[model samples]
Target: MQICVIGCGYVGLVTAVCFAEMGNSVTCIDSNVERISMLQEGRSPIFEPGIEVLLSSNIRGGRLCFSATLDDGALRGAEVVFIAVGTPSAEDGSADISQILSVANELAHKLTQPAIVVCKSTAPVGTACRVQNILDQHCASLQRIGLHRVVSNPEFLKEGAALNDFMRPDRIVIGTDDNQAQQVMHQLYEPFVRNHDRILFMSRRAAEMTKYAANAFLATKISFINEMAAFCDEFAVDVEQVRKGIGADQRIGHHFIYAGCGYGGSCFPKDIRAILHMAGEHNRRMPILEAVEARNQEQKTWPFRALQDQLGEDLSGLTVTIWGLSFKPGTDDIRDAPSRTLIESLLIAGAQIKAFDPIAADNIKRCYPHAVKTGQLQLVDEPYDALQGADALVLVTEWKQFRQPNFSLMRSLMRNPLLLDGRNQYEPALVEREGFVYVGVGRPSTQPVAAALRAVV
Candidate 1:
């Protein structure tokens, strides 16, 4: 199959590379000339693991290429064109699908032959229909009506394991009323789902809704556990124990059950907002989802509030170390990350921050240039180096490298042996046994009884 993937962002890049790896000819197109140039040089603009290797291999095999525009001979003889552009959340919480629309309009003019246009981006419901309408109208004006087909094929790739997710998708949802489009999509995705027929045929709207609902449900689970963690904290109970207790039931699996600072990334936060906006447009009230969003927003502030509670409302002259900056590990994406919320709060309180992440350090440095220039924030090269002379440490993202550390060295490096486990990555008793005061989500620290009583009194 000759495929053209519009947008060299994470999804588009991964999709193009993986398809090319499967022996399909793929040309990835992006408007960003620099990004396309990087891809053409066998370098991935995103921080996904193993993508550049696959991209280089495919390019070497003459199966994959990159271009800056669709008119640059990339769209010639393309059987399937994927609209994988970013649909970021707008100010009103709706998905800003201007990118998708723009691509559709461009394809109307550029595509000289009939092709299946796949909506690979997570857009609002009816987005495929809108794109179809746009293409249909423009094609009619050009006296080539019904020359193209549009399919909703939203991506379900995880950030860290996108390659694996694309190579072995659990299920492939193809949304189109056109039989030809459905068959073509199935043939394209047939290699990924060989064990069984996992290709689900559905209407375009349902497919789009499925993407939002899937992300929204996962976000709801995260917010639900965070809410439970808060309740457990009120009773001095460990949310970990509660999580395990509930997870034992077969009905309730252990996925997304771990209580953390919050859920953040390109998908969950933005998709939830888009769905809520969709509901609002139809005069529908999703109170539960509203609460879920509210809880998540509050959850992101947990580490900041905990720091203030430990070191007083005014954090002036305090030196705090942060363990992670990316929203989660395996990717350098900090969109709506809890570390940003914590950093913002800490900087406002006049606290100096030393942050360390194996891959996200440079990105964080870019985000806080003023603080970095003023010496209020330091993006360190080493994890322990960030702890040097720090008053307390906050574990924001649970990176694999941060799972265990030389606690004795950490104790000696810090000005105060205080720890806030934002991801509940550490055991309270074990950390306290290492001679440090440890506070975790819904976990009580081993504070002195006298100090607790005095505080209560």
Candidate 2:
């Protein structure tokens, strides 16, 4: 298939390269000439694993290419056009689909032959239909009505494992009433799901809602576990144990149930807001989702609150070390990350921050330039280096490097042996044996009974 992807962002780049890896001729188009140039050289603009190799291999095999514009003959002989542009949230919480609409309008004008336009970007309900209407109108203007078909094929790729997710999708949802479009999409995705026929055919609106509902449900699970963790903390119970107790039930299987600072990425936050906006537009109330959003916001402040509860409300002159910056490991995405919230709170409290992440430090530096310039925040090269002279160590992202460490060195290096485990990545008893005060989400620390009581009181 000759495919043209009208975006070189994470989704579009991954989709194009993966399809080309499967032997489809793919041309990924983007307005950013620099980004397109970078892709042309097999350098990924995003931090997804296993993508650059695929890009290089497929490009060498003449199955993949890139373009800066559709009018530059990128749409020539293209059978499928994917509008995989971004739909970041608006100020009112609705998905800003201006990018998708602009791409659709361009394709409608440029597509000289009949093609299947796939709405690969996540958008509000009726967005796919709206794109279809644009194409229909364009065809009507030319008296070549019904020349093109539109299909809603939302992506379900995870950030870290996007290549694997695309290569072996759990399920493929195709939304279209046109039999030709459905068949073409099935043929394109048939290779990925050869082990099973996991293609779900649904209405366009249902497909859009499915994408939003899926993210909202995952966010709800995270917020639910965080709320449970808060409750457990009040009773001196471990949320990990409670998580296991409830997760053992087959009906309530564990996934996204781990108590953490909170979830922050491109999808969950934007989708949650988008769905809530959708509900509001229809004069409906989603109180549960509203609570989920609220809980998540509070959850992001858990580490900061924990610090204040243990140390002092005013963190003046405190040297705090943060052991991660990315929202979650395996990628360098920090959109709405808990670390940001913690850093902001710490900065306002006059705490000197030392943070380290293998890949995310540079991104974090960009976020806190003043702090970096003034030496209030230091993005260190080594994890333990960040702990040098630290008053307390807070684990933010659960990177593999921070999983097992030389605790003896860490304890000796830190000004105070206080470990705030944000991801619940450490066992309290084990860390206590290492001669450090260990605190975790919904887990009691190893503070002296009197000190703990005094702090609680």
Candidate 3:
């Protein structure tokens, strides 16, 4: 199949490369000349695990190409045109469909032959119908070309693990009333679903809602667990044991059940806001989701508040250490990361920070250049380096390396020997026996009187 993928961002690039790897001729189109040029040279503009190697191999094999002009290459005779452009959040929390609309107009003018335009980007419920209307209007104005079909085929790819997710999705969702569009989409994705046929065909609106619902539910789980962790802290109960007790049920699996600082990154924050906005448009109120959003925001500050209660209002001249920068492990994305909130709050209180992440230090440095310039913020090469001479340590991300570290070494390096586990990644009693004041989310601390006093006041 000849395929054209518009907007060569993370989703578009990965989808194009993966399709090309499956022997489909793919041309990734982007308006940015520099980005297209970089792709054309067999270089990836973003950092993904196996993207560069796969892209170079497919491009060299003549199955993948990059272009700035959509009309010249695969778009001319493509069987499937994927609209993978970004739909960032608008001021009202709904998606800004301007990019998708603009691309629909462009593709309408250039699409001389009949094709199926798949909405691979996460969009609102009726966005496919809107794209269809836009394309229909454009075709009518042209007076020469026939109308194309729009299919809602939202992507579920996660950053840092996108290649694997695309290659082997848990399920493939295609929502279309047109039989021809559905068949073409199935053929395009047939290779990936061969092992276990997980293609779910449904109405276009339902498919769109599925993506948003999945994200909202996952965010709800995170926020729910976080709330439970807070309650466990108040009542001197172990949140982990409580989680195990509930997660043992077949209905509630253990995934995303661990209490953490909060949920962040690209999906949960934006999708939850979009769904809430959509509910408001329909004159509906989702109080539970509203609480989920509120809890997540407050949860990000738990670590900082814990440290403040331990040390008092005067955090000036304190050297704090941070373990992770990205929202979670295995990715370099720092969008809405909890560490950013904690670091900013600590910095405002006149405290110094030494932070380290296996992958996200450079990305964090890009966002905080002034912190890097001054000695107030230090990005260390190794996790232990972050603990050197620090007064307290906070684990923002539960990376594998951070899951099991040398606690004795940590105790030896820290000046004040305070450990605040934001993710609750360690056993509190075991950590305390290593000669440090260990604090975990929902863990019973030896000295909760200070925290309780702070909460009361």
Q: Return model 2's CA RMSD, one decimal.
A: 2.0
Candidate order, lDDT descending: 1, 2, 3
Error of 2 at 222 (Å): 0.7
lDDT winner between 2 and 3, please give it.
Answer: 2
Report model 2's TM-score to 2 decimal places. Answer: 0.97
User: Candidate 1 has which clashing residue pairs, if any?
Assistant: none
Q: lDDT for model 2, on a 0 to 1 scale?
A: 0.90
**lDDT top scorer:** 1
Using lDDT as the measure, name the better of candidate 1 and candidate 2: 1
- lDDT of all predictions, in order shown? 0.91, 0.90, 0.89
Error of 1 at 247 (Å): 1.0
Candidate 2 local lDDT, 1-457, one digit each (tens): 9999989987999999989998999999999999988988989888888888888999999999998988888999999999999999999999999999898888889999999999999999999999999998988999999998889999999988999999999899999888888899999999999988999999999899899888988899999999998887666778999999999998889888999999998889989999889899999999999999999999999999889877878899999999989888888888888999999999999999999998889889998899999999999999988999998999999998888999999999999998999999988888989999888988765344445577689
Q: In candidate 3, what are the lDDT values of residues 404-436, reduced to their tens digit?
A: 899888888999999999988888888889988
Structure candidate 3, residue pairs in collision: none
Q: Candidate 1 residues 1-457, lDDT tens each?
A: 9999999988999999999999999999999999988888998888999988998999999999998977779889999999999999999999999999999989988999899999999998889999999999989898889999999999999999999999998888888989899889989999988888888999999999999889989999999999999887666678999999999988999999999899998899998899899999999989989999999999999998898888888898999999999999999988888899999998998999999998888888999899999999999999999999999999999999888999999999999999999999898888999989898988765454345556678
Alpha-carbon TM-score of each model against the true structure: 0.97, 0.97, 0.94
